[model samples]
Target: MEKWLVVLGIWAMCATCAVLFIRGATGGGSGKRTAAEKGVRPASRASAGDARAALND
Candidate 1:
């Protein structure tokens, strides 16, 4: 019936979307980098001496 056809079409669309989403989520074809790999580093914790120097400024 037409209703069953509609349901099948919708199901097919959903399956396609899920496949694409999973592929993208897994980075199938593109190069990806982590923060460290991109040469980004987190700032080190400030020491007490650094705080004193800032207060003196």
Candidate 2:
């Protein structure tokens, strides 16, 4: 029982470490810009009309 507990503890620690390592390697969700940060403006009707006209040609 003691050995099993030890193995379980080690496995849990290893899994936690792996998750932390992967999160750090992938920038931990901090690198992506939010919609507000990216300055995404709403498209105007005229702009959409122009895009449709261009696409048709």
Candidate 3:
């Protein structure tokens, strides 16, 4: 009985991990904020560097 309980706990943990992995694969929990949502233009690497340069002026 004790051994069975241990196996069940491990199985549950693995199943939970698999479900979380699948959800992430399907974009279920992405917390990324879009530029529109933040009311900003999409920034590229060059634009970011320009912004920093401007700030240093």
Best by TM-score: 2
Candidate 1 worst ten-residue window by lDDT: 39-48
lDDT of 1 at 4: 100
> lDDT, candidate 3, residue 47?
65
Q: Count the backbone clashes (under 3 Å) in each candidate.
A: 0, 0, 0
lDDT, candidates in the order shown: 0.66, 0.67, 0.67
What tens digits encode model 1's per-residue C-alpha lDDT throughout 13-49? Answer: 9999999999888875333346435654335423346
Order of the predicted models by lDDT, top scorer first = 3, 2, 1
Give a tens-digit lDDT track for model 2, residues 1-57. Answer: 999999999999999999999988886544344632565533542357757744633
Misplaced by over 4 Å in model 1 are 29-57
lDDT head-to-head 1 vs 3, winner? 3
Q: Which residue pairs in candidate 3 collide?
A: none
RMSD of 2: 10.1
Model 3 lDDT at residue 48:
69
- What's every prediction's RMSD, in angstroms? 10.6, 10.1, 7.8
Query: TM-scores, in order shown?
Result: 0.50, 0.52, 0.50
Candidate 3, residues 1-57, lDDT tens digits: the string is: 999999999999999999999987886423444533564544543466767745633
